[model samples]
Target: MESKGILTKLYSFLYIRGFKVWTSYRTQVALTILSWVLPVFTYYFVGTSLGNSLVERIGVKDYTSFFVIGLAFQGYVSSIITTVSGRIRNEQLYGTIEYYVLSRSGVTSFLFYSAIWGFAVNTINAFIIMSVGLGLGIKYDINWLSSIIISVLLILSTLGLSFLSAAFTMVIKQGNPISLFFSTFTTLLGGVVFPVTAMPIPLTYLSYALPLTWALQGLRGSFLDGEGIVQEGGIILVLLVFNVILIPIGVLAYKYAFRKAREKGTLSEY
Candidate 1:
């Protein structure tokens, strides 16, 4: 095959090829879609039970829309940080890590693109969650341009951490403490399911350090209140700063880890 054809096949397999296998199971599809919706109600009822106080305290118009946005976008952050590491783990188990790590596209590009399917699946989940919120009469005043910009900023910021997670996987070939720590802390501190103000003061400071906290705030403002880029300028700047600091460190760590792993001849160890 020509180089162009080869590249096309590689991307085809990376992107939609797994869809056929996944959809082959009818029950899995139904259950997966249900899983996306069930959580919306879970949080909805839970938030409603707490009443308007929580909503007011959080500065959101209502708890339903607030929690809905948080629940929906949290999936993207999780997917970003975990997908590449999960791909590496699977490849290691299959004894195929060496092939991709040593391939012409190299480990960085191969592992990064390998995560496209996971992001696509998260998009479906986000859409379903938003639809459920709408069905429940949760209103939104979306600012499309700001929403897109914030979403992209969120993804890029999280991508840095994901790169670091991949590097940890390459080196350890097993449990990943780096991703684990961030995942745990992000849920508690990043204000994914709750307002950061609910946490103690010190913890709130830590929450401010997380990219997800800023992303969720900016997203909720744009998606629920129609706040535009000018209104979201501070958030955009914070996310940009995070990207600037994290991406370079992550890239360096990942490249270093990959080089060391290859030198140690343990790229496929698992």
Candidate 2:
């Protein structure tokens, strides 16, 4: 099938990138260990201080465990966004993006492969952190079915956001600001470190509108309550709806920007 061929290409791209990242074995392992344990120390102390008072308010039985799962998932989702948006600039500077874009490969194929590479790398990081948490006795819901479904939805939503940022890069010729905006917004409004429901009404509304809000909620649901997936089905549904609408818009915007860039002959300019 044509779809299968595309996926094969995507998978090969991811495999190559992952192999390269893994070649830095010592650094990768050390950083992965730090990622897992350092956060536990920070959140465990904070959560213990809040104790049952905050745990109950946040609708989770164990605040520390809840925080750890949410943080791990947030790390993965945020890393995907960060890498996809920033990779274009890196490749452009390195003289690879122009080659890829102008090659026989379709732009769609190139973008998909780049995103697959990012997703693969970040997924490894997420797994290392989560496995360490489990070794430390952080009980996970382990609903693979729900986790898979939510993961697909999260990737779709995030890929749409990635496209928007790529379009910004294609049009404006830089993506650092777009990356900064999403990173800051995710930390503030994504409910990774704290519950968004605790925020005031206005901020709560704003948080709900952000894509990462839905992502964190779905991830927390998948890993923490297990019931959160079914109970917060509305959020998941909304995210699905958002992907359906935004992905097409993002694609059109990206194509338009790409055409403009080609016309201006600015694709190679840093």
Candidate 3:
């Protein structure tokens, strides 16, 4: 009961803090919405220009819809890494990280709640982006149940990467190259703008190593092909395996990095 009470307070603190931060930057919020929406027009035009050839190559009936789904999922993936890492860096820069380390609620709890807030905000952003795409006439035959299942798995897999990024932020202090590299790598290789099959053999094999590859395949299967969880069983299994393997490794890495940073007297350094 005491533990549950602690969790409740921690959650309330994180949620209120997130709400305050978002509301304080109304103009930035509007620009962020515009940034997400504006890219769809460029993709829509490019997809239309390519016509049926693009559809045939991608094995999807509508290139615009395919691209839109990929882009939406990319938003979720990017947010997890960038938000977790960036929040830690921001706390360090603001000299509040030491307080986090000393907090009764615990640093890990703070990190986890911050990540949850980021995931919630980005999920809403993805939905808005998809709605805008639909308004632009990007058609989808969505399987809501399957999409939800795939989304949960995607979030779980992504949390592993998020934790890894947080670990790097602890050690590096600033300029998280791992986050940047993963963002670009996933964009190119996770079939965000194009199909992974179009890549060379080596690149195709390499793409399979990233959890986002299976996530995109599962998402596209549900969104574009109307596939269910049963139909996407293989991709789901792969993602499950990734979550099981990566999450523990990521947590241990973060804990080790945090400890090293403290011992080196670098945790509060910026």
lDDT of each: 0.83, 0.71, 0.83
Write model 1 residue lDDT over 1-270, tens digit each, in one string.
Answer: 588865785666554565666678899999989977998899888877888876677665588887889888887878767777888898899998778756777778776665566667778889999999999988889999999998888877777888899999999877898778765667777887778998899999988998889999999999988999999999999999999999888889999998998899888888
| Candidate 3 TM-score over all chains jointly | 0.93
Q: Write the per-residue lDDT of candidate 3 for residues 1-270, one digit (tens) a residue.
A: 998976786567556677667878999888988888888888888888888875687666777777888889887778878878888998989999999888786777777777787787788788987898889886778898989988998888788888889999999877787689776778898888788898998998998898888888889889877899899889889888999998898899899999999999999788
Best-to-worst order by TM-score is 3, 1, 2
To one decimal, what is the Cα RMSD in angstroms of model 1 from the true structure? 2.3
Instruction: Give residue 1's lDDT in candidate 2 (0 to 100).
Output: 84
In terms of lDDT, model 1 sits at 0.83
Please, what are the lDDT tens digits per residue for candidate 2 over residues 102-197?
676766567766777667766766777677667767877766666777777877777777777787776676635656666566766777777888
* Model 1 CA deviation exceeding 4 Å by range: 1-14
How high is each candidate's TM-score? 0.92, 0.86, 0.93
> Per-residue error at 80 for model 3, in Å?
1.2
Q: What is the C-alpha RMSD of each candidate to the true structure, in Å?
A: 2.3, 2.7, 1.9
Clashes of each: 0, 0, 0
